[model samples]
Each structure stands twice: as structure tokens, then as C-alpha cells.
Target chain A: MKFAVIVFPGSNCDIDMYHAIKDELGEEVEYVWHTETDLSQFDGVLIPGGFSYGDYLRCGAMANQSNIMAEVKKAAAAGKPVLGVCNGFQILTEAGLLPGALLRNRDLKFMCRTVQLKVENNNTLFTNHYEEGQVINIPIAHGEGNYYCDEETLAKLQANNQIVFTYSGDNPNGSLEDIAGIVNEQGNVLGMMPHPERAVDELVGGADGLELFKSIVKQWRENHVNN
Target chain B: MKKVKIYVTLRESILDPQGSAVKGSLTQIGYEEVQDLRIGKYLELTIGDTDRDIDTIVKEMCEKVLTNVVIEDYRFEIEEAN
Candidate 1:
């Protein structure tokens, strides 16, 4: 399956995302600029972490307005797998593809470290490879990773099993209910703070994130290739 | 023309850590009377004469981009400009 790594101005993690898909996952991938309007050719879209638009106005706020986001939305509506990490996660929320907003860290610090994440729901396309209730280690690096939503949305997320991952030991950025990651109602779009792309290779420490990419391919294969 | 001043701040339900840190520093410097502080953003926009109504224009901009209504609230004041 081919993946498109969306690149916005000031985005620094595009290389890591490309490496993860091209080298680690061994999937055909290309870097798509933020101005590009077509995403129909890609099977899955990956929005990587970085200070897009220098985190100006707000994290991911400016990047969300790029012309390509409209295409991203259409791709998402078509049930294509769309994955966003870190600032990419923020962009997803800003674009309204995902609910909730990311706030500043409760401690007012930009934290960068590997943390434990519990697989709260593995039935989704993003976490299918993860066993239900399993704990996985992934690195989270961000200043505004505290995810917030109103009580009603929270209730809906809980009811629909959209809460895919949560902090295991300690809530890193004080995200509500330790929400490390979440998927949209449709279940094909996922946004998370952890840089799974950064951990796709074992040589760099751990390869626990490889399964996430594999899961996307597996789901697509099951639907298109196998069927 | 009109000059619009906009202020954006996190909603009351959301915690403001940077704001609290500044408040803590003020107290540490003997300003114990300082009760609370919340950090926010200030924006200024100059609107030229247009077919669109000013109120609707500012409201749309704030709702769509200037502020994230999900976590923050925004208020604007407009001044007629030369």
C-alpha cells in the first residue's frame, strides 16, 4: 500500500515519517506538500510531528488551513486510513477531523520522553495489531499535548470506543483521562501524541511501533487485496 | 476601514498552566494578593471596506481560524479606522 506523508512548512518530522514507511515498513511512500490538493493516489495518509508554521497562532492552527487539508478531509470521508502524530494530531483536531483540542502541558514544560501507552481499544484499524489492554512504549515530545474536550464529547468518545490509547503509568501532559491517543467516530482516522514513526526501527531502541503501520496495511489488504 | 482587536483565552473549564506559573512567580516576589492569572492571545486585524458585514466577517474569522472554540473563547472590539 502507498502512503503519503503530508509536509507543511516548518514540519521537521516528515523525514522520520518517510523513513518509517519507506525503509521500516517497506511500503511505497511519497512526501506530499501541504499545498497539494490531491490525495486520491495514496492508500494511507500520515501526518508527522513538527512545529508546523512554527507553532504560530497556535499549535497546528495555521497548518490546518492549508489547501491540502480539504483533500485530507475528503480522503477521510472516503474511509481512507489517516494517521496523525504529535503536531499532526493537533492539526487533525484543528481541521475538525478529530474532536477535542490540545492544550499546554499542565506543568508548562515541553516534555520529550518515551512513555507507556495502554491499548484501550484494539478493534479499530489503527490498533488492530495491538492486543486489548496491552501496554506499549512510545515516545511523546510536545509542549501542548494536554487534550481537552467538553463532558458531552468525552461521554460520546467513551460510549463509542473512540478512546483508543491512554497513558499507562503517568499522564505525561495531563491529558484528560490520560488520553494518549484517540480515533474518530468513523474509526479510520487516528490522532496521537506519541511518535510511532520515530520508533519504527529496533536499531534505534525499539520497534514496537511497526505493528501500527502493519495494521493499516493489513486492514487495507483484507478489504481490497484479499476480497 | 476598521481596526479589530481580538482576545482569545482558554475556556473556564480548561486549566492554564502558563498563567498559573506567572501567578506563582508574582506571589513569590511578595505579591501574595495576586489571586489568579490566565494567559491568552491578542490579535489585531485591519478590515477594509467590503461587501461583507463587519460583525459577520470577524465572527467567521474567529470561529474558523483566529481561535479554537473547542477550548478557547474569543471576543472582539472594532474601531472605525481612517
Candidate 2:
């Protein structure tokens, strides 16, 4: 399956995501610039982490207005799968592809370390490979990873099973309900504050992240073949 | 020929840890009775010779670009430049 990784100015994790997809999963991956207006050539899009636009104004705020967001929105609306990691998650939320906003860490510090994430729901296309409530270690590095939503919206999200990941031990950024990751209502778009791409290989630390991409690619192929 | 003033703030429902921290310091300095405190962004824009719908544009900017509407609220006023 062909995967397109979106690259924006100040995006440092695109290469890491690319390598994780190609070198680890043996999947065909291509880099797409944030200025590109067309995404008709790929089956999936990955918005990797990093300080896009140097986190100016707000994290992912500037990157969301990039020329490519229009096409990304169309792709997402058409049921195309999109995965956003770290700053990418911020961009997605800013772009309105996902709900909730990432706020500054309560400690007002940039947190960088491996944290345990409990998979909240596995029915989505992104987490089918893992059982619900399973804990996995992934590195999270961000100064604004705190997720916030109103009580009503939080209840709706929980009832809909849109929440995908929650912190296992201590809540790192004071995120509501310890939400580390979530998916859109359609379950095709996911935005998580952690960097799974950074932990997809044992050499780097662990290979827990490899299967996420593999599962998506496998699902993409299955759907295409069925069609 | 009108001027607009915009005030953006985190919604009251959400916690303003930053603002709270500052208020705590105020209390530590022997100042009590500070009931409420919050932090927000303030923006001033000048539009004198443009026909564009500045309000619509500004609101769109706030929702899609400027303030993250999920956690923040924004309001603006247009007035004659003093």
C-alpha cells in the first residue's frame, strides 16, 4: 500500500515516520509537501510530529493553514485514513479534522520521555491490532499536549467510543481523563500526542509502534481488494 | 472606516493553570481576597481601506487559525479610531 507522509516547514519527524513505514513495515511511502493541493495518489496520509512553523502563534496553528490542508480535509471527508502524531495532532485539531484542543502542559514544561498508554478502544482502524486497555510504552515530547473539552463533549466522546488512548500511570500534562489520543467520529482520522513512529523498532527502544502502520496498511489493502 | 478590537480568552469551563499559578503567587505575597483571575490574548486590528468582511474573516481566523475555539472564546468590536 502507498502511504503519503505530509511534510511541513519545521517538520522534523517526517523522515522518522517515513523510515518507520518503509524500512520497518516494507511499505511504499512517499513524502508530500504541505503546499501540495492534491492527494489523489495515496491511500493514506501521515502527519508526523515536530515544531511545525516553529510552533509559532500556537502549536500546529500555522501549519493547519498550509495550502495542503484543503486537500487533506477532502481526503478525510472521503473516508481516507489519516494519522496525526504530536504536532501533527495539534495541526489536525487546528484544521478541524478532529475535535478537542491541545493546551499547554500544566507544568508549563516540555515533557520528553516514554509513557505508558492504555489503549482505550480497539474497534477503530488504528487500534485493531491491540486489545482494549492494553498498556504500551511510547515516547511523548510536547509542551502543549494537554487535551481539554467541555463535560458534555467529553461525555459524548466517551459514549461514542472515540477516545483511543489514555495515560496509564501519572497524567503527564493534565489532560482531561488522561486522554493521550483520540479518533474522529468516523474512526478514519486519529490524532495522538505521543510519537509512535519514534518507538517502532527495538533498536530505537521498542517495536510496539510498528504494528500500527502495518495494521493500517493491511486494512487499506483489504478494503481495496474487496472493492 | 471603522476599527475593531478583539478579546480572546480561554472558556470559563476550562482550567487556566497559568492564570491560577500567577494568582497563587499573588496570594503568597500576602494579598488575599483575589477571587477570580484568568489569562487570555488580546489583538488589535486596523482596517481603514478594505471592503473585506473583516468580522467573518476574523472569526474564521479564530476558529481555523487564531484561537483554538475548543478551549478559548473570542469577541471583537469595531469602532472609529480615536
- Tens digits of per-residue lDDT for model 1, A1-227: 99999999998889999998888878899999999989999988999899999999999999999999999999999999999999999999999999999988988889999999999999988888999999999998999999999999999999999999999989988999999899999999999999988888778889888889989988898998853
Error of 1 at A180 (Å): 0.5
Supply candidate 1's per-residue lDDT for B36: 88
lDDT of 1 by residue, B4-47 (tens): 99999989888887888899999999999999898898999999
Give the distance in Å from residue B51's predicted Cα in candidate 2 to where it truly belongs: 3.0
Model 2: per-residue Cα lDDT at residue A157:
91
What DockQ score does model 1 reach against the true complex? 0.92
Residue-pair clashes per prediction, in order, are: 0, 0
Compared to the true structure, candidate 2 yields what TM-score? 0.93
Ten residues in sequence with the least summed lDDT for candidate 1 chain B? B12-21
User: Candidate 2's residue-wise lDDT over A1-227, tens digit each?
Assistant: 88889999999999999999899989889999998989988889999999999998788889988889898898899899999999999999898888888999989899999999999998888888888888999999999999987888789899999999999989999999999999998999999999989989898899887777877977787788875
The CA lDDT at A47 in model 1 is 93
Candidate 2 CAPRI grade: medium
